[model samples]
Target: MTSASSAGPRRVVVVRHAETVDNAARIWQGHKDTELSERGRAQVQAAAPHLAAYAPSLIVSSDLRRAAATAEAIAGLTGLEVRLDPRLREVHVGEWQGLHADEVRERYPEVVAALDRGEDAPRGVTGETMAQVAHRAGTALREISDELEAGETAVVVAHGVSARVAVSDLVGLDQDVSDAVFRGLGNCHWIELVEAGKSYSEATRWRISGWNLGPWNV
Candidate 1:
């Protein structure tokens, strides 16, 4: 297993896309193609310099508008082509796609219960399962790690849920640690991953190479 500590500076930077208007409204933006809010754009502006510090060789993000826009900004800063990868899309919430937490609890308590059951709940409205999201995200991550050619660093911009899940899979995190990875990452926050030997490791292994250089509170 390649340890990050032994890999020098070859790293992966996991970044949460900038916030959207829906985030400000507390609405579920899963799979929504909402544009970045003005604040979201500014957040990305603030974060660009920090991200450019990586001098990333490649930048990938969800094809959805919010994520795509965020990726575009970083691409501009680093001059790396922004590649839209569908596997990095946000987990589809189906019926709960646009609903707030209170609305979900009030109208679909059963669906929420299913979500808490440690499995992907069926799309009460039209959603994909967490299991499905994990499958695609895990595959994409592995491909980036094992297939990256000539690049010393690659950056992936993703959503909240899948970001935690992907990192959990990479680091073999226990459930609690995996679940709480979100605590350290905020909107437009950057987490650095160091690959040791051929094995993978989490951002905790590195210094705050870059951080929540955004205006939003995550």
Candidate 2:
């Protein structure tokens, strides 16, 4: 585990997209580009004031509709344009994309069990490995952090699984052990990562200052 230190960026708030219809149905929506549900829109709207209090200088989002919509809500509040990045998208679930959680559990009990036990399991035959998602998203976040001047902040709206993986990597957890330390973010929830140093080199250190913050938390 990385030690908590006051060294990194002023703050990097990474948010999970708001709820969607798939979420309401407990369906696996990885990379499926579902739009926000009515509750999702409300969640985003409710979170806007708290997010605005963070005073983020920039907003970045996955190009997927759910994430994009959430980012747009915050952007509307902050008057910041959202920069879209497909690399910030969710993990692709391949054959399991539209399956409900119970259905997946029944069909792939062992795989689901492994995941519940904090072990890595395949999402599907052609889906991305967690390590791959972590690498790409982590790299993107590093680039974003590298560009920020001191005391600047940015909000990154992404999906639950990818956000957890990226944050685990950012804090120096290896992929194998990442799950033990990082848990999934709830819809419209966010985590704040603070840099442990001013530099953004490969060896940069970070500490999670906040986790799973949302309107409810406020």
On TM-score, the candidate that comes out on top is 2
CA RMSD (A), model 1: 4.4
lDDT scores in order: 0.71, 0.83
Candidate 2 lDDT over 1-218, as tens digits, reads: 23323443467899999999999999999889797899998999899778878899899999999999999989998889999999999998877899988887788877777777766566765688788899899888878776676667889998998888888777777766656655668899999988664445434467787889888975
Best by lDDT: 2
Each model's total of backbone clashes: 12, 7
Q: Which parts of model 2 are misplaced by more than 4 Å? A: 1-9, 113-119, 197-204
lDDT of 1 by residue, 24-101 (tens): 888887887887888888889988777777788888888888888888898998778898888988888877777886
Candidate 2 accuracy as lDDT: 0.83
